[model samples]
Target: MNNTSVEKNLANKTVFPILFAISFSHLLNDTIQSLIPAIYPVIKHTFSLSFSQIGLITLVFQLSSSLLQPFVGLYTDKKPQPYSLALGMSFTLTGLVLLSLSANYHMMLLSVALVGLGSSIFHPEASRIAHSASGGKRGLAQSIFQLGGNAGSSLGPLLAAWIIVPYGQFSVIWFSTIALLAIIILTFVGNWYKGMVGVIKKNSHSITAISPFSKRKVVFSVSILLVLIFSKYFYMASLTSYFTFYMIDKFHVSVQSSQFYLFVFLFSVAAGTLIGGPVGDRFGRKYVIWFSILGTAPFALLLPHANLFWTTVLIVPIGVILASAFSAILVYAQELIPGKVGLVAGLFFGFAFGMGGIGSAIMGKLADETSISHVFFLCSFLPLIGLLTGLLPNIEGDRKKIKSNK
Candidate 1:
């Protein structure tokens, strides 16, 4: 059969069972990943680590996660790996064991890198699975997949506060059960993936239709998307890596109280993520992208100036608005590139990780040199870059109309 015919057949088959499986695995995977950041205060106090040291920990973890992802995606694009996800989770299990046993700062960094390595392996291929299972509902599929990670992220601080903070660093070992659960789940996903590959092999030709836009236009559009990602993830780096610190510094809140506030912001992120995909599917992703990123400007600008109560209130909107852009952005990019789903997912995910890492490190240095308040003020302007959303081509109009008609 021709590529178009194969595309149609695949598009008609939305596999919810596999989607939910992968989404659940994603929750387990990210919950493990989020623990690294969530316990920063505990580790900082335990080891008497500096802010730069904390940033370096993120840098190491994120670099390990980011640097290998594109290569893994590229390799897998040519040669699909059905069982790699399960194997990847094993690495995470080992990392968790090591983290619990870590004696000092260096050990913690090494431990996190192993966890990062597992993440690098998991995301690109799992994303391909999501795409395969998407049928025609790419936005909703990506959103469902992302919602798990966001929810898991929201859970980390609370988990840390309840389990790790009260019980101490040794309590990290308790969470290793989550990794084992993911391994078993991913093993099942791998089986489903194996079956799906056979179907693709039987019916589909390698995807090679020329993109509607010229190569130059595609490159320019991707550049704009990457810039938007940088703006989003960099701003996120400030919040994710340092927001707890900011709360403690500015409000004199206790560590546990700061974590609770962090949980609120992250929960809002989960809620926003759930909304972005369906909305993007209904409307044009471009409009959703525009609103998701640029819409946060007012709240983001206000966050730094707010007093304690208002600061708490403001993060809800900030999290919701900023969190919405990613699903739209990922789906938009996939549409632009057509068949390079693995590569595209890898590049965007990797770049997002890289940007977040770099942002954390830079902000860490800035915070050390100046203050956390100054860092927030500087990041408030990052969202203004969203004005460039106007530059994205109007590619989704036909899809939007079709979706509307249905």
Candidate 2:
């Protein structure tokens, strides 16, 4: 219960049981989150919505999700709220129920907003929990945590295609069961977190973080990382928000088939998430970030010109390559700003969601004004921003130098 005891407790080997529990909870959380976007087509028809309207829905949901995260992370870094996880999921459950029962546009917005609110709460604490339980295996822990989310995300479209698309709007209520299950899992995780509350007062300040770079260099590096995030998530917005429509419009694919294709892309993403962290742990995170983002450029450039079959093939590499970047980027940022795990997680996750929202809105309008093909073409250039990876100071290398000096 004392500070030294707490440090010893926390510094022990990675707690795999706690890690997997949180990862499974993340899967349940994101599975519910993904439902909103997945059901867009059905709701578009039911409510006679426009592409811009769809973008606005994302905007609202994302704002609610993004805006609160930094503050939530900051607050929890101070207080370490053990039970907030379940509280957050309760909001999602309410949102799910409302979304299922929603008969009008405004109500739908409110429902999605509530769901977004739940996400803003969940990520920082969950991420902190993963970090706390990581011992020394930061990258691997983050990857395992993210794998659940990507896997859950990949399930959304497929589940929507099977469940909601056929059963109609009311069937979204069925996913309330998913939300409830998450709440149960989160409650269990919360109990574990409660036991760690002995570290609260010293948690945010006790650890001495040594940065190899100057404050200016660190700030500049963070800006570059943000830019990279913009590139990755903006391009991601094109695919996650509109890929199905793009498929139907260009290839004349059925809605179900488009959903199936989206599943393939997201499943590849899940696979990549599993790879990024461990590889970053083995190699330098800078290399992982460089390869993951920049590596996607070739396939992205080829995507607009490919036929339906080729497009499907291209999305696999796109998803896999692009998906690897986030885990590395996040872990790299945490290394940069050590001990502020919640803030780092919240900032990056919030910014990623913000970029995705803004990107979706801008691209939706672009698709309305130009064509989805044009939108895809323009977005293809985004991965090129990964070139900024050259500028980041090598944290791992710097740490090795520090140790040798010691």
Candidate 3:
């Protein structure tokens, strides 16, 4: 590619609406998931929630999302379409709006469940679409889309901090609904409706549906990936759960200060996701995954030791390392089960991450009984799973043997 050609390619890249939708939907979904932890204290105090009940609320979101993702993936992989993507975002956006409006625990749980289901539909489909639209730049496209989630996750708390005080949590819903409505408009204007439906009907490839019980190689790879997934989730849930508390308890920072730092951590995640994809594309996906995982261990181990005013410089990198793993590994997991991208997305994102939330609750309960530092210690050791992942045989992102037929 010449300089002029490359420049044109880059310019053309900016005009893909399908890519925009995928990223926009991701931002909305992740904001909903990540924002809850920050606001839980407010809700807990209002509803008189105990520690376990708080964990249960988080667990409910993960469980429903995890359980529903596989079905969504199955349907999506079998028939890739844009409607599912649009519909999923609409559902997720609607759920977030409802979340802000909830007056009771039951209503909150119900709202979370909707967000979970909506997310379930969006992730796999958006990923698949991004990969397809990438036109051989799958890594960059995936990275861009992945960044949306991180961006939303980061923005959610900051927005909540601003809006929740004067207007309340329900006010956040208007933001999601309005943003989603724009995506809906963009979806039609971008002509994603006809394009995606056409693509779905065009798919006629045979996907190898290997049962995990029988395929040791695939299952073992999946099991190893699950370990990575679990560790990532622990980092996600535990960090969000206690980060503000840690700041207040250890550094004597005020609630507002701690929350700002927490937002910074999330924003770092957005940066990591945006960077990881291109790095993966330029290097190798395996290298990106393994390096980030290994890089995280030292950070995790060192988190408790940062006591000084300037130590947060160290904390930001740790957050990036922890967050970047998802974008790379998520794509890697989908690639592992080439013909079953949706199922794999569901299994990795929904199931493994869901199970991780349960594990996180256990750690939370342990914190209640034991020392929170001990919980962090246990969390640190979980990254050892990443070392083991290096041993799994790598796989291609898609079934090249069948692409010609498609």
Candidate 4:
């Protein structure tokens, strides 16, 4: 009879259509975001930038993107904003235009900060939408959502190699079209979300997950997760922000060839993203978190020492293995604080970005003071931080066992 009635009649089952729609929007949004770093080589050369300056660009961008997400998530958790996703896209569109026209370093920084602002608005609300539509399949929904982002990220380097490099900086203007398309799709999604908001608000209190840990235990576990995120993203920064440079510096690969290598590693990330969520749903998020972060240790340790061919080969497993951790970690955190989905998403995503930004800056400085090879060698030890995952209390196992006994 009404919005609430309409929502109630449909079983709380997964909404595939909406899931796919949001995921596609994610792909579009991240494609635009990835362009900034994708064209780093071009910008670096065009501006006569040092590694520290390059890293500062990323730091500024990431800080803008990361800083607002938690606040946005917290605010939206209290008061949902359906059309904000579209609004975020508008910011991205503006940024894309400015970036294409950027004539100097300051202009580039300003352009990326605008794009980062858009991302700050996008992730939290989008994550909430995915969680709401999940219908108990949180991990799978998150993975599907994440797969699109990773896929889009992988495309950036490849596209930059083809478009930005050949045609020059002006070519970035073309991706403004991608941001525009995302805005349109997000409008449609916004309409659907508008209708669902009433129902979602009513059902919010019932969305509690059963956690077996005490409050102190939950907080401790979350701290462990954050530490794990720092380790993961710190390591990831070396590859994502510097791997292309590393390739050119060490192997004497052409700039275009280096981008192709970056693309391969990123594509592996997209492929591995499918593993964590569904597997976590079946097995346990903790186990997935453990293997995903720690399993990469062997591969990562070998990566910096390998020859060019082997370096490329080793990056695949490193990317794939490390890529699996986030979905598991995010879902696990959501489960930790049952009702604060938005806050958890915001906190985790924001922290990841912050770590990445910080890591890039530090690595850049290290590379400048020493060498890119030294940076890679030092980062190789980061995955070993996964050992702290053992400190995570097995909340999933406890919840299952308690239910079975009852």
Worst 10 residues of 2 by lDDT: 198-207
Task: State the lDDT of candidate 3 residue by residue for 1-406, as single tens digits.
Answer: 7755554443334336667766776776677677777776568667888666777787887787788787777887766555666676677676787888898998998888787777777776666666656655657788888888888888866866777644666666667755466457546633654454443333313224443233677678777777777777777777777676567667787666777788988888888887667777676677777877778888777777766454477668877877667767766666565556667666666865587568657866777787666776677766666787677664543334345558
Model 4 stretches with alpha carbons more than 4 Å out: 1-11, 209-211, 404-406
Local accuracy of candidate 4 as per-residue lDDT tens digits, 163-251: 99999999999998899899999999999888888788778765555566788999999999999999999998899999999999999
lDDT of each candidate versus the true structure: 0.89, 0.90, 0.69, 0.91
The true-versus-predicted C-alpha distance at residue 288 of model 2, in Å, is: 0.4
Q: Order the candidates by lDDT, highest first — what do you get? A: 4, 2, 1, 3
C-alpha-based local distance difference test score of model 1:
0.89
Model 3 — TM-score against the truth? 0.84
* Model 3 regions more than 4 Å off: 1-15, 182-186, 196-215, 308-311, 394-406
Alpha-carbon error at 308 in model 2, in Å? 1.0
Task: Note the residue pairs that clash in candidate 2.
Answer: none
271 in model 4: Cα distance from truth in Å?
Answer: 0.5
Ranking by TM-score: 4, 2, 1, 3
Please report how far candidate 1 places residue 133 from its true position, in Å. 0.6
> Candidate 2 vs candidate 3: which has greater TM-score?
2
Clashing pairs in 1: none
